[model samples]
Target chain A: MIYFKKVLKKIISPYRIAGSLFSSQYALMLEYRAEIVLWAISGVLPLIMLGLWTGAEARVLAGITKEDITRYFISAFIVRQFTAVWVMVSFEEDHIEGKLSPFILQPIYPFWRYFFSHVAEQFTRIPFVLVIMIFLFIGFPQTFFIPSNKELIAAIIAIFSAFCVRFILHWTFAMVNFWTERASAIERVLMIPYLFLSGLVAPIETFPESVRAFALLTPYPYLLSFPAKILSGANVNLLQGFLCLFLWGSLFMFISFYAWRNGLKQYSSMGA
Target chain B: MAIITVKDLRKNFRVSVKRPGLSGSLKNFFNRKTILVEAVKGVTFKVSQGEMVGFIGPNGAGKTTTLKMLCGLVHPSGGELLVAGHKPQSRNTSFLKDITLVMGQKQQLIWDLPPLDSFYVNAAVYGLNKQEASKRIDELAAMLELNDELVRPVRKLSLGQRMKAELLAALLHRPSILFLDEPTLGLDVNAQSKVREFLSKYNKRYGATILLTSHYMADITSLCSRVLLIHQGSLFHDGSLDELTLKLSPYRAVRIELKEPQPKGLFVNYGQLEEFNGCLVRLLIPRETLTDSITSILNNFPVKDLEVCDPPVEELIGNLFKNPNY
Candidate 1:
């Protein structure tokens, strides 16, 4: 479509702008190589959880084994690293610094630039981190397994939707910048849901029936648990997953738009 | 027709001032105090196409507030403003496509990547074809002397280099109008002159209208024939430099080297005589009385040497705002 081409052109037209973003990201990674290694070390949470879960399976529970635990946790680890929400950090920084005005003046929409840079960084992360997981899967074949083509296709779609859901939700939270001077405190409190409900540390199914039902109704589960579940051959209805994703994505889309519109109304240019 | 017009433009902000101290901070948890500050108060102006107008004021004088309004970066509390036939506050895509705002403190360059990368991204955002965007970039870079710096990371470049790159990025689309806010800030004297020269050349070359705000008088004197002086969010003076000078302080300064030392009382009534030594005195005279004052001085004393010139424009602008009708 012409509209799509126009959007694409805008994204690439400022080649230097786009190039700078990628270069900055790569350079940042280089500068913080040690920090990244430390972060990778903190990913020990999943391994710890794997040990706890495997120890409890004196007899196999839901066909889960030491192998299953390792594979599932590693997959969770890989997903968690890849899907980290940087949009919130940059948005909050710009909002607080009063730098958002310059972005608003540009001929192109700021949202697309933000979206593209984040997506581009993800491509970079694949080589730096995702491939490491791929090799891990190769070494631990008993626990980790690749999905079939049909499931892989479905999971890919699910991952993309999940990414959208994550971006929108994080953006919605970042929009809190308009109302409050310090949004990280608010974001920190809000991040509890992603941890408990999104199956980051444990599967959502393991929760009590009542809590599980509530978690399913929220957007957090779609962001993390859905794709991993599909890849693991979990018995989830394809149509139902698609509908759930659509509903959550639409809900966030609505929230982000409203917040952006309202936020713009109160955007005062700071200083002289 | 006016490319930019503003009427009764006003912008006010309600800022929350957090109370200090542990007890005061605790009280702020339940109740907070807010104050309203008017940044731009009922100022108005009109800029036609191809005009290079300077907007100058003291720090916190709201020069930037008006510039931001024209660029559609901030909405005004009360005003009517149209840039390129579009209401700036609406910031419609079409309106944005035709106008560019370059702020010296803020930049669009990707800090870690070559400025060209940012240019490419802007190209995509503007929907320019590869060839067309590159052609424009090449032209702008060449004009800005940015050929070597274009491919280097922005952070690696000097402040002057970064500014040149920023200008190139903003101009890639060749917008019909430019709103430049302190575009030459922090550059060394040589770089400042280069930037001013490029801006003047660009304005003439493309016939691009420019509305620039800066504390740098040199930038105004070199690049803008017409300047708008703002004070306390209001338009204090809006006219060409010549008109401003003639209207504000139509006076000439007279300097004389006396043949012998003279007492101060003799010259005090004529004007404020600034004497570096007993034999040298400088007198300010109204423009109409310059000839009479010189003749009187010559008749009274043996004038060794003499010179007369108008007061600097900056002094006149300062006087105009201090006493509006003066």
Candidate 2:
């Protein structure tokens, strides 16, 4: 009986399911390596800003050295590449192509498929990112710096957590596809605040105190700024960063499933 | 025992109305107009365990809507539905495990990966162990006559190979009930025959209940002894395939070959002239008038050969939507 139970548990385990899904999704992701390379290249904004900020004196962001700013921007670049979420675009494609129907008919929740798909895409992006970083360090060896072991581990955890928060947040918006056909247009509006406050353009510290405080209130700073700071070996409250990510991730997860239930009703009414 | 039961099932859609022309479009931009469409009126049916029944209907006749409701993809607007002793709209995991829905041309396989990769994913999702999944895959592959195609990318496969692969993916869990919509659409004659054969074999071996909808009459004629003919959002007939053709079509087709030649006009006075060439003429004479029409044509024209039979189900059903009353 114990042997049987273990078999049953293993069969139903999420790890086994995720392993199968990830392997299949990884194979599919590699087929689009050319597209992923271009996507990784497009995330060069932070590196470009690093160059611009390196020349500025202590005036740009108070209480920070030129070398620290360079490390911060490089950290931000890595964080942005790993935590980038595009569930909105993918969900819209599946919704339009009638692929969602097949997904809905299956035994598993459909978002799990999309989740593994996003994770697989991140894996595919790793090689391209390493190449870019190698070019950067070779061209300007002074920019190279090794983060402490603790800092590297914390940043990896933080970046992955931030990805969860961002994925659920964007996926919550993707539910708008069930109401209307096109929801990618809304992504453009989401970009305005995300670009401004996510520390992608510049560090949130450079902003006025009021603006920084406001940005912190939203989930934007936790997504990139907190993780980037940890990666750059800067001092940060690890507990607060993790807590904010957990709280925001939980909130969006609840709202997304609620929207999913209602979205199904609307799906049937859209002419089956 | 009835494994599937539905009563007075209905689906109503509230759709926006868009008028033609620039002026109407401009006016509608300010305030959109909308209307309620009753896509499926009251439809009721039942199928016993291991029974394979055909649900036949034209486009926009609520066939797919009804199937969607059975599989829990679409919630019913009203009425009751019970499949495998569970409410489908609840979408319980147990219920999902007991059923599967397959739609034509829409795929569940990852496009870039080989079908074998997706089969593994599906097996894991359905909680099948590697050994069990591999065993079932081998069995189904032999049954489907699938070989190396499982390892080829899905986009590279022929339409027939892709469809067979789709059936394999869907049936991986061995669901007790199957809901298939246009499963044989856009396939060659040989491919359709193979699918029909496989479905029959699967049903017999596992005693699975099937509710299939298809525009291909051959799919129904061969696989389903019983059929549910639907039209204009209502159930029209529930009987054998032959009975459906008989009820819908009140006319028998008569053909005659003249030794020489005859104008189409020469046959029209006797019955409705469906076809007329120089040597042969086809007519749809009402059953009541079939004898009189044939006699008159034979007595007048030098009939070299004569034939009479009920029209093909394809022809009868093809004209059904045009004459919804029939």
Candidate 3:
């Protein structure tokens, strides 16, 4: 009985439940091995931008070289892959199809399962990403910057924090389905601005001063550019960057929580 | 004591009305009309511990909505509901632990992976250890006769197998109360009977209170002694199946085999003639007048065989829905 009690306690604990979810999701990711490869390949947008920036050297702003652009875009590609959150599409599909009813009925909160699933995808995609990075470095050894130990540590922290912020923001938007059926359309509308402002197209520094200021004011910079900037050894205020990420992450986290609570109240589990 | 009690429970949903065609779609995009649907309107019922109750209703009569509310999947707009001594809408951990809801249309099983993986995930979510969860899975798998199917991907399994696996996933936690909505839906005759047998045995062995909703009359007839009938989002009747039949139908079907060819006109005075062939006849007569009608029919006609029985449960339920006041 004592052993059983211990097991029960362990299983019910949030941390253990999250760990189990992560493991199951990791296994699921393995089953989607081909899809993982396709997703990783999809991150080649930044690499293509790198080619564009390298060819248009005259268009490049002062103090930014072709090699610098290469490193910046490569770091952005890595950050983009790590921080990717497909929760909007998946959540919309699940909501539309009534697949979320079972999760809603579970004892554990449903968000943790979704969170673990995305995190597990990232964990599974790490090796493939590393392989790509290795190939890139082998081809253009001059472009890649090996960060200092301290910088590497800070970059890891920033990237992880960025992933959290992006996940929460995407989840918050996904909750729009609770009120309307056009959540995917809304997400598509939001994606255009996000693509420009999140440094997916170009680094924030490459933008005009006014646009750069506006981008920094939004949460998009902390989600993608800040982490990429950290990894590229760019001259950035580390303290300000971390603080901005934390503030935006907390804001989005609260919004997501609020959205979820309200969403549950409105959720009819219609099809099920 | 009643394990589940619902008093004046209600649910309302606001639905957006969309217009058809490009012009109407554009108009809807600007100003969409909305309507409120009263899915469950002031339904009330109670189920005591270890009692298997059937919540029978026609489509859109709020059976699924009520079940969803009891399981904390859908929130009630008004009224009170208590399941296992907890307010269902609160969805407390203890309350959730004590109950499981199974909807045949929705599944918890991971589609691409073996059911064992999903079972382990449910075990973790429900706070069951590896050893205990495995033991319970084994027991349930054995009961469900899902020996090899547990290891196969859920998508690969037949519908019956998938539903059985879904049941095992739900029951692994050993919930004290089970809310089954259309649990035997979309199954063949053999699979349906097998599912009903398993459910009856499970309830008996575990003493779990079960509230089931199914369109199949056989499901309710075989497993539930007491049933709540809902029509138009209201509880029309709550009693034993026999009581419901007697109350709504209040009639017996007297099937008779004639000794010779009988005129259909001759049997009309006995009762309402339901069937009349060359040498066979069936009549629906009021229960109170059953003896008189049978005696009269026998006295008038040369009867070879005769039997009196209540109308089929399906017909009785059908009549009840058509005219709920009965």
TM-score-based ranking: 3, 2, 1
TM per candidate comes to: 0.90, 0.92, 0.94
Interface RMSD of 3: 1.1
Better of 2 and 3 by lDDT: 2
Residue-level lDDT tens digits of model 2 in A164-257: 8999999999999988879988888888888989888878888888999999888998999899999999989999889989999999999999
**lDDT of each structure?**
0.77, 0.89, 0.88
Sorted by DockQ (best first), the order is 3, 2, 1
Off by over 4 Å in 1: A1-44, A57-68, A134-141, B18-30, B246-250, B274-277, B315-326
Interface RMSD of each: 3.6, 1.7, 1.1
TM-score of 1: 0.90
Q: Candidate 3: DockQ?
A: 0.74
* lDDT tens digits by residue: candidate 1, B1-326: 78888999999988777867998897887888889989898998888899999998887788888888888888789979988989988888888888898888887787777887778767766667668988999888888887778887789999999999989888888888999999988989989988999999899999999999987889988888889888888887898777777877666788889898888778876776655478989887777777888889899988899998778878876765677553
Which candidate has the top score in DockQ? 3
TM-score of chain B of 2: 0.87
What does candidate 3's lDDT look like per residue over A1-272, in tens digits?
99998877865677767878998899999999899999999889999988888877443545687777787899999999898888888888888888888888789877788889999999989999999999998998877678888878888999999998888888888899998855877677777877999888877877888999998899888888888888888877889988998898898889888998888998988678
Question: What lDDT tens digits, residue by residue, belong to model 1 across residues A172-266?
Answer: 77787777755667667767998899887777766778999999888787777777677666666778777887887788779888988787777
